[model samples]
Each structure stands twice: as C-alpha cells, then as structure tokens.
Target chain A: MMRVEEKLFQNRYRVDGARAHIEIVDGDVCAVHCQDKPCTFCCPAGCYAMDNGGRVTVITDGCLECGTCRVICGEHRNVRWEYPRGGYGILFKFG
Target chain B: MSEHFDAIVVGAGPAGNSAAYTLAKAGLKVLQIERGEYSGSKNVQGAILYSDALEKIMPDFRDDAPLERHVVEQRMWILDDESYIGGTYRSANFSKPPYNRYTIIRSQFDRWFSKKVRDAGALVVCETTVLDLHMDGRRVVGVRTDRDNGSVYADVVILADGVNSLLARKAGFHGELKPKDVALAVKEIHFLPEQTIEERFSVKGTEGVVIEMAGRITQGMVGTGFLYTNKESVTIGIGCLLSDFKKSGIAPYALLEQMKAHPAIRPLLDGGEMKEYTAHLIPEGGYNAIPAIYGDGWLMVGDAGMFVNAVHREGSNLAMTTGRIAAETIIDLKARGKPMTARHLAAYRKALDGTFVMKDMKKYRDVPAVMDKNRQFFTDYPHLVSQAARTILTVDGVDKKTKERAIRKEFARTRSTLGLFADAFKLWRAFE
Candidate 1:
C-alpha cells in the first residue's frame, strides 16, 4: 500500500565521494539567451541557476543524475555527461 | 567447481535487490552485480515505494527502512498557463502506523536494500559492469564482466539491469525500445528547511503531499508533471513520450520550466534552494511492449523487462513486485526440480497477470494511445476549463444563470458540442 508520493524524500544513498563521481567540463553551461532559460526552469533539482547577470551556473554535487540537462541542453553541447564514478550519485531509498 | 553461484542477479535496484534478497534468504548462493558504485547509485525516481510488495519480501521494512515522509494527500491537476483545476484527496488513515507509502531517494534506498541483500547472505559486487552473457548456444550459463578473471557462472541469470539493459539487447532477447513506448523524465530535488517544508505544505512531522499534473504542462506532448513533498525537500519533475519530444521539437526542459513557473506551483518553492537535477527514461510500453522475459538459462525483471505502470506513476513497485515474483517462481521451480526454461518461466507472467501490475496496466493500455491521438485534451481543454472556472468564481455582478450560460459558451467556443461530447465519451471509454 506504499503510495508513490511518500517515497519522494527518502535519501537512501549518501554521496560517499568514493562511489559517486561527477565532473563539469568548461563551456558546458548553456550560454544561450533563448527567451526562456530552459535549464533554469526545467531542472527539478534546480541545479542550474541563473544569476542576476543572466549567466547559468551548475552545482553538480546535488545532482540526482536524472539526465535531464543532457537532453534539454538541446544540441547546445554545453554539457559533457557521464555517470558518477562507481558508487556515487543519487541513490534511491525506495526506487 | 568454477566460481559458481545458485543465481547471478545483475543491477542492484529494486528488481535486482528483490531477486537477490529473496534467493539469498532461501539459502541460495547468490551474487548480485552492479555497475554503479553501489545500489541505487544509478537510479532516480519520484519514488513512492509500494509497501504491499516489499512487505511480502521484508515484513519489517517499516521498522528499519530509510523512509522519507508518509504521504497523506494526493493532488492531480489539469493545468493551463496560470490556472489548474484539480481535486485534493487527503486522508488521515495514511498518517496512521504501518503507513502505506513513503517518498524515497533512489540512491539511498537502493543502498539500504543492497545492504539487506548482503545481510541475507548474497555476495554483492559493485562498480562492475556485466559485459556479456556467457551463452551456450541458446542458453545463458554465466556472465563476463569488465574486470580480469571476472567471469562467474550461475544456475540462473536475472537481468535487472534497468531501462536500457544492454545485456538483454546484446543477447538478442529484446530490441531497442521504440520512442513511443518510452518516456524521458527529468526531476530535481530542492532543499528547504524541514520546518519550512512542514509549514508550507500544511503538515506536521513527516507528513507529505504529492501532486501529479497533466494538460498544458506538457504542451500537447504526451507527458505529465509531478511534485512531491519530502521531509526537507521537494521533488519536482516532468516527463513525456519520446515520440512526443521528437515530433514537437520542444525540449523536455522547456516543458519542465513552464511547469515550475506555473502560478499554482511557484508559491510552494518560493524560498527553497535548488539542489540536484537529473533525467532518466522510463519504459512505458505497457502490456504490449513487454519483450521475451525468459529464456533457457535467464530471466528478466524490472525496467529491463519494462515493468512500469506509467498511469499510476508506479514503476519501482512493479519492478520490485516483478522481481519478487521472479524469485518466487525460481524457488518454486527449484523445489519442483524443474529446469529453468521459457515454458516454466511463463509462470512469472501468470503471476503478474493475477496482480495489479498487469491488471492495472491492461486497464489503461489504450490511454497512452488515446491521449496521443487527442492533442486537444492537452491544449484546449485546460484553457477552457480554467477560463470557465474563473468566470464562475468571479464575484462580479453577473447573475448565476448568466455565469452558467457563459461557462457553456466558453466550452462551446473551445470545443464544439460534438467535440466536447466525444472527449467525454473517449475519457469514459478509456478509463472503462
């Protein structure tokens, strides 16, 4: 009877740096001034944030590794992606 | 003789863990292999774990599982640009002990389940990818890994390696998933003070709310959006059929952005700090999309076999349930001294059919197609509904009868009488 909503908050995996690996390459942040900063709006985790100057910065650590940015970047080629090394990334408690 | 196990289960998510744990508990020598550093490391979900499924495997899960908040309420919204019409269902029974569903972060949950698998006496090796199935003509006997001397034999191989299970495809068990049968989803977790989350969501300790959305959120694309309240963060996401993305030419992120900026949605996350963003594909092929699930020496479970109930946003439970059933079937077969063969393994399908997994999926089998063919439901209906609601709810001097007439006219303007009747009938039939 465990419903779908209750499991959203359980952080079952702690990012032990040894297993979870993420690297942000240079020029990966989308620089496009498209009417809507899609990444800024679309990322569920809000990993991509737009500053007052309209530049987008990403803090990779908090990433759940859902792969949205890669697809949404839309051939922008601003993001280089790979799985977090071995054991580090968003671990699901119930998923 | 060789480094042989009773079973080798690949991937350590719900399905893998369930299979591994069940087998190990039954005193089978099991080896669960994971490519990620740990279980759940490579997983993501707006995850709501079904207790009925897990309780069948681990009855005491509630006592020690890393559970987030027990959801006491659910909201389904049909959204337009700035308005949504939806109903909220909240029940105090959900807050009671032996709570039904809880929100979970995939990374943490999988690790916890993996620990249980190990505790149940399985040998779990992480950070290793299973490169190929060691096949003897038509039968799989073992797996070869990337590391040296990494080949291991087993009596049965369980493919729980997730959505894009390359091993299954390589073994020619299934082909590449079709675009229409899959959905690409993106989600983010925003960190907020626990107190703030509690206050904003109008909940006490460890209580949560989940909102599932449709309509303009997907911009005529066949997709949905979701927001779930956690203990200290909110998980929000949007997903659509891959075919929708290809045809619409609008990025998934754009849909997500619009969903987040929704006036009804924005207030909930006003001051929260954004945390993580990620995306993954979900297998939504339903009953028709399931591939060959078993062979002479192997069986498939979880996303590998595409056991996702997209209508209910129920994938992990299906994964776990299917995994458990697969394990149970193997146990029963072993007890009967039957060899693992496709014919014998079809029992797994029979079990699934008797359960909600297949039943519910079959119930909604035509929904995805119906929605896809009817783009007006996503585009025009929400706007019309919202405008009608606005007109009705407005406190202007219009008479009640006039307001009702205006609402009727609004519906007619967007959808002719026949169109409205057809939509209603289609909806009724689709659910029926």
Candidate 2:
C-alpha cells in the first residue's frame, strides 16, 4: 500500500536539467484527442497525469525510463520518446 | 573518435553479454556498447536464471556468478480473490549440486557477466548508447554512438538492445511493435534478513521457491503474476499486454499494491522493507510476432528479436541462446572467410530454428492469439473452477452426487457445454 511517489523515491536518477527525454509532441493532441490518456495509467513511474486544464502533464525527474509512454500513445504517437542522455535517468540500485 | 572493429554489439543484457563473450573468446575484435551507467544499471527482471543457458555460455559460470538461490520448488496457483487452488512441484533432485535454476538480481548479474565478457577479450564500453546504425547502402556496417565523433565501423553489428530496441526500429529492420505483442510488467524487491527469508519460505541455505500465479490478480488481463524468493529479499510482479492496460486504464503500481495485498500473498513479505520498484517489457507475441531476425550484415538477439517463450516464462534463456547462436554464426563465417551477407547470416536463423529456442516458440506460437481472444480463460474460469474445487472439498453434509451436480451447474452457468469443449480444444491447439 505504499504510494507511487514513495516507491519512486527509493530509486536513484541522474537528472538532466535541460529537457525531458520524453515529451508530448503536441499538447493539442492530448487536449483535442486521446480521451483515455493511456499514458496516465500505464506508466509505472506515475510520470504522466491529467491536469485540471484538461491537458496531459508530465514530470520526468522521477521517470523510470520504462518506455511505456512511448508505445502506449497508440494512434496519436505523440510522445517523442528517447532514452535519456547516457549516464542519466533512473539507475537501479538492485535491478 | 571513430574506430573500426570486426563487429559491434549493442546492449549489455543477457543477449549482448553472451554474444560479446562468445565473439571475444573466438578472438574477434568485438566492441560491446551499453546505454546504462554500468552494465546492468538499466536492466530488471523477476530474474530466474536457467543454468543451462548460462552454463552453455560459460561452462564454469557457477564458480563465481552472484546467484541468489537455487530453486528447489515451484508453485503454480489459480486464484480467484481470497483463496487459490495450487499445484506444487518440489524435488530433492533440484536441491542437489549442478542445480537447474537460480534466482538472480539483474544489476549484479549483468555486471558479473560483463566482466566475463571483458575477461574473454571483448571491449565492453558502458555509459555509451548506440544512437543509430551506420549503414553502407542497405547493409549494416557499424554503429553511431552518443560520444563525440563516436561513429565506429565494423563488418557486422548485433542488436541485443533489449525490448525497447530503438536502434532496430530506426533502421527499419522491423516496424513499430504492436501493443498487443508486448507486455508491460512491473516488479518490486523487498529486503529481509536472510534468516527470516529462510524460515518464512521454509528453505535452507541457497535453496529457493518460485510461485507463479494466474487468475483474478490480473483482473481479467491476459497475463500472470510471479514471486521469486531471493536470498534475503522477495521479488514479486505482474504483467499484462500493453493493449490490455490501455483498455483497462489501471495504474500498474496500483495493480502491484493490490496484488501484494492479496490474502495469500501478503504474509510472504510481512515486515519487509520495499527498496526498489522496476518496470520492463517482455516480448510475448510468440513466433508470429518475431520479426526479420537477420538481414544483410545485421542480426537481432534476445528481446529485440522477440525470442521469448511466454508459455514457459522463458526470455533470458532464449536471449542467451539466440545471442550464442548469432556469435557462433559470425565465428563460423569469419573462419570460413565468408562475408556476413543476408544469405550467410541466414545461418543464424537456420541454426536457431534447430534448437529448442525456436522449436518451443513455434510450439506455443498460437498462445498469444488464443490468450488474447479468450478473456474467459483469465476471468471466468479461475473464479468458477476455484469455486467448484471449494464446493467439492468442503463437506457440508451435502450428498456427494449433489455436490457433483452443483459443481457441474456452476460450470454450465459460465459457459455452454459445447463452448466449454471448444475452449478445451482451442487451448490444446494453442499449446500444440
């Protein structure tokens, strides 16, 4: 019954300040389309969620880099997914 | 700086390590690249190592590998919510030396395997990702890495870049992986005192138990849950097709928490500290989803090649076996002074087809499709069967014949008599 935040807190990451390795290619794609917003549900790290503004929002700092968001986008294919720069992103202590 | 090699291998998971180790031992100038900070920093698994795979790669691997515990018992469970109908296989033979399987932690195991690859004479480079494949016309000639002036040339490149395999996609070796063909699995490891684990799991030194569960835990998704006992920690996780998760709209972590809270599963991790949470994708599409594995001067191995045998929950073995075969193919061609053209590289696929790796995949080739189409197999059957088992086992003064009739009625309520027979036929054919 631990929170996703607490579970992610247990992991280690090398944060890249400039940009997230993954992004919604266009915010309008989520605003006008993607009613289910599967990324919100499938991402294990809880990096994606819907905001009050009727838009999908993401925070990549806690991202586990699982690539779920990349593929879950389905028809939209709006996520411009890339691995974080080498040496960055979640580093599993135990894997 | 750009450099050339006899071959370039991408990714450092089991597949890449096996390929590199074999190529290196064969005296090929191999450069193995990894995107993780270290060899296994990006890898995760429920992590049961089939000793046959590792032993084939390095015969004496047991002498120094960081294995968690050798498995002596395996439990398969069919659960509805609270109770489970389970079958257990325990063997004193499994407990003896030259064990068949062992629990492992990927980060530790990959590091050790990478070390072995290096010792075998391959150049293992970490913290460097292969961004793209450098192609000469249509043939893969080398790889372009993330480093400054990182373009390196080689006669052939082996793509062992795990399940995500962006490089393979970029090169158009295969199109986008259908969500239906892949599964998203999330797992967590809980730390406990070694003695506590030994006593709770009812095992002695280095002996482990594995539990594989299927039923309401996945909430009707086409998937299964597993728990593997490591030396001092327990690894537990559930996986379902991506398409199912998208349709179900269930948060994966929430699913994990709910599964851990299951009455039958909770006590196994009582008082343990959860240290890490990890998520990974498994190629579950069986033989039909396996893409073009070898073409031109390139070949695919491991998850990238979709060599997983989902029926047996075997990916790493297929990964290692595929990697080994690919390496052997390259070694044979090099020794024969042959080029790694698609025709020659066809040997890799041909040779793999002769092994259990491809044979098992072909055997269960229809499983994913059958499993995907049959929702009742996951939801209704588990509930009804468990209910029927309870009905038959509990003596409430009901006549034996009446109990049998009741169970039959319950089963008939779920499916028609013809439909039930057809379901059995579909299952038999799927596994045929």
Candidate closest to the true structure, highest TM-score: 2
| C-alpha lDDT score of every prediction, in listed order | 0.79, 0.91
Which candidate leads in DockQ? Answer: 2
Model 2, residue B406: distance off in Å is 0.4
DockQ of each: 0.18, 0.81
Please name the candidate that would achieve the greatest lDDT relative to the true structure. Answer: 2
| Candidate 1 TM-score, true structure as reference | 0.84
Q: What's the CA error at residue B25 for candidate 1, in Å?
A: 0.6
lDDT of 2 by residue, B63-132 (tens): 9999999999999999899889989999999998999999999999999999999999998888887889
The digit string of per-residue lDDT tens for model 1 on B1-432 reads: 259887999988899999999999998899998877667767778878778889999999977788889999999999988889999999999989888888877778788899999999999999787878999889899998866788999889999988877788778887666667778887768788999988888899989899999888888888889999877889898898776776676655556666778899989877876655556888887877888888888999998888888878898888888899999989889889998878888898888789988898889888878887998988888888888898889999989899999889888877889999999999999889
| Model 1 Cα shift for residue B24 (angstroms) | 0.6
Off by over 4 Å in 2: none
Per-residue C-alpha lDDT of model 1 across residues A2-54, encoded as one tens digit per residue: 11122223444445554433333443244434445565644445567777766
